[model samples]
Target: MTRATASGKQRRATLLGVLGVFTVHALLLVSRAAWAQEVGTVAEVEGTAEIGRGGRWSPASVGTAVQFKDALRTGHPGRVRVVFQDDTVLNIGDDSHLVLDEQVFDPAQGTYRSVIHMIKGRVRALVSEYYKQPHARYHIDTPTAVSGVRGTEFIVSYDAATEVTEVVGITGRVEVTSPLDPTHHGVFVTAQEITSVARGKFATPPTRLSDTIFRQYLKGLEFIGGGHAESLSAASPLLTGSAIPRSDRSAAFEPPAAVAGAAPGGRPNASHDASDLLHQPPGIVRALQNGNGDLGVRF
Candidate 1:
């Protein structure tokens, strides 16, 4: 061909090559966005942990993609931490068996939901405040009861032998109710409070826990093998007593208000001041000022 024709062909070839590169990059971007739809990532794993589906298991490690319906189990001295897209964190304790029953995060529609089926053992969760948004639901279901939360840091434990489920609220709130109850009546557990639901029974009223007992429960979730046990220092929110907003909804059974009684000289009784423990739980208020200090109030 003539020189002019050859030059024209060369120009067209270069244009096509650039277009092909652009197309490939676009496709890669789309692929990555789709892959990110998976529920969460295994942020940390220690000792013997397995994740699987359909009863077949494989060893889990950091960066493992946790998907819908995925089952996770932790053997002796094992622990797994999962971080979700919405900033919720879950630390599964040793000897735990759980399934990610349902998880959906769609920012376009402003919808978020997560449901964990805890067959046994413990899961310490720092749930995201996004769960309080409209059309959001977060729940941990056990054989005996369902522990639901809008946003909170909490620990859930279920005992297979006793068929009992217990929930301890560390920061925000957790609502524990019996699955068998149609009326959905349950107690609202606030920060530093705890409740339990036994087989065929409703959730018990939330009881305030002292700082000593609360710290002991948190120590149980530390990764012993990873040397992360010291992570629960005074700076930690659980220990420092950082306050999260309380749930706007009321519980089926709110703690009784401060009982009115005569002290003397037409004044309210001093004993009545301690009655409203639900709003001002002892440890939390005290810890906010002095880390790990004694809460002067006795439950």
Candidate 2:
């Protein structure tokens, strides 16, 4: 071929080579995105809560998609509710740091698995029954302990300063074990039971939950909206001390302010309608006082 023709052919070949590389790079990006599956969504957020990915933090709001390995954190008086793809609900309390370590939902094989690592503070979980599949498992790992559940409602609190971990069972059963143990020998905490794991120790034997600790656990997970600091302050008595009067128990059960148009006496108007906003479950106040086992709330 002529020299000019040969040069044109080489240019065409180089262009095709560049285009092929670009196509491959784009496909790799798409594959990476697909591999990072969305494991959950932020159903509600109050005060200062953030999502962390790749070591960077961003403000979290309702409808924010959470992928595997994402970190969730909250500031003082901040609260967040996350609903996983399997309908498992996680309520992160104020001043908490948690990470989604692993989550997989395989409908074809009827399997689901998840691991949430709690670095500090508290979290309440309302695990859906859909996780009852034979091979399904859910775990919440703390610095000292690991809580495993199949289908249950429970609370986990980790204190970074003290290196202590506490697990309280609201309904069903939760197995609390030391994270360092390979055998997974643990204690089963059932409804109305509580267990604690101290630094470098196995979980304490499960025992009946005390009214004082139960109230504190519930308050930690309760939703806080505007002006909630006042409510929380009012419930300070419940957070402290080892015992509280049964009659005074209602003092800690303050409900959040009604939506703008949702007040009982207000003129009927459009407003957000969901139990998540009205965080308190029906008759929860009574349940607290009566010490009943019917304190289940789906949110």
Candidate 3:
């Protein structure tokens, strides 16, 4: 072939190679975009308060969807409340970090499912049945255990020190298991029952609070009477000698105890008193200040 003809053939080959490279790059970009759209994404952050990282704190606003690295800190000394679109509420306690793994909502079917992974901390969830459906699922995973709930209210805590998980049912039933030990997993706990799972072992038997204990639990906030009011009045150096109302007196009294026990899977002898104090009937607020200080309440 002539030199000019040979040069023309080489130029055509280079042009075809360039076109092939561009086509592959375009295909890869399209694939990535499609994959991201199908995956889970944060919907919204209705309300958040006193969120912190490292040691600094800042107030979070609505429409701010939580990212993977945004850690959550409680506003009050006790629990932080989070409300979802389905009216499901999660009350996270102080010094807790909840990582959102996946969340998807289907407007057509009115179905929503969420999965949250707790690295370390405590969370109390009140699952509403308003949007009750079979497909509505809520799952929480810890370092050692996992909990599944269809429509129930429960509390879950992960103890980094002991590598254990504790779960308490407040409204409905919950199924808890150890994903690490599938052979000995699958346990159901009803309302007012507590279940614990250790690091490598399966979940333990459910512990139902005795009626007396439950009754006392129900009256925990009402144990003290008017006499206690006088005691609080006399003890308060700041307040005048005037007697504080029984309701107000009880509100001022602080219990020197750690409510809410250790991780559920911990030894049976573990302090259940702590759990009691933490989950006391509503209207009673217990606060733990400093490192080892006892429970102090503002009633």
Q: Which stretches of candidate 2 lie over 4 Å from their true place?
A: 1-27, 223-295
Give the count of colliding residue pairs in each prediction.
0, 0, 9
Local distance difference test scores for all models: 0.67, 0.68, 0.51
TM-score-based ranking = 2, 1, 3
**Per-residue lDDT of 1-299 in model 1, one digit per residue for the tens?**
99999999999999999999999997665544432234555656778888875457878765455655668999997888765655576888889999987666655556677889999999988777679897788999999988888877788999999999889887778888898883578889998898999999989889999989987777658543333422333443333434333232112112222222322122322221221222232333333345454322111
Candidate 2 residues 1-299, lDDT tens each? 99999999999999999999999997665545433445665656788898887677888865455666779999997988776656677889889999988776665556577889999999999787767777888999998998988888899989999999999998899989996683566999998788999987888999996877677667757644332212222333222222333333222222222222211222232322222222222122223334555335422
Q: How well does candidate 1 match the true structure in TM-score terms?
A: 0.63
What's model 3's TM-score? 0.53
Candidates 1 and 3 compared: the better one by TM-score is 1
The Cα error of candidate 3 at residue 210, in Å, is 5.0
- Residue 176, model 3: Cα distance from true site in angstroms: 0.4
Model 1, C-alpha of 186: deviation from truth (Å):
0.8
Model 1 weakest 10-residue run by lDDT: 248-257
RMSD of 1: 18.0
Could you tell me how far off, in angstroms, the CA of residue 15 lies in candidate 3 after the best superposition? 9.4
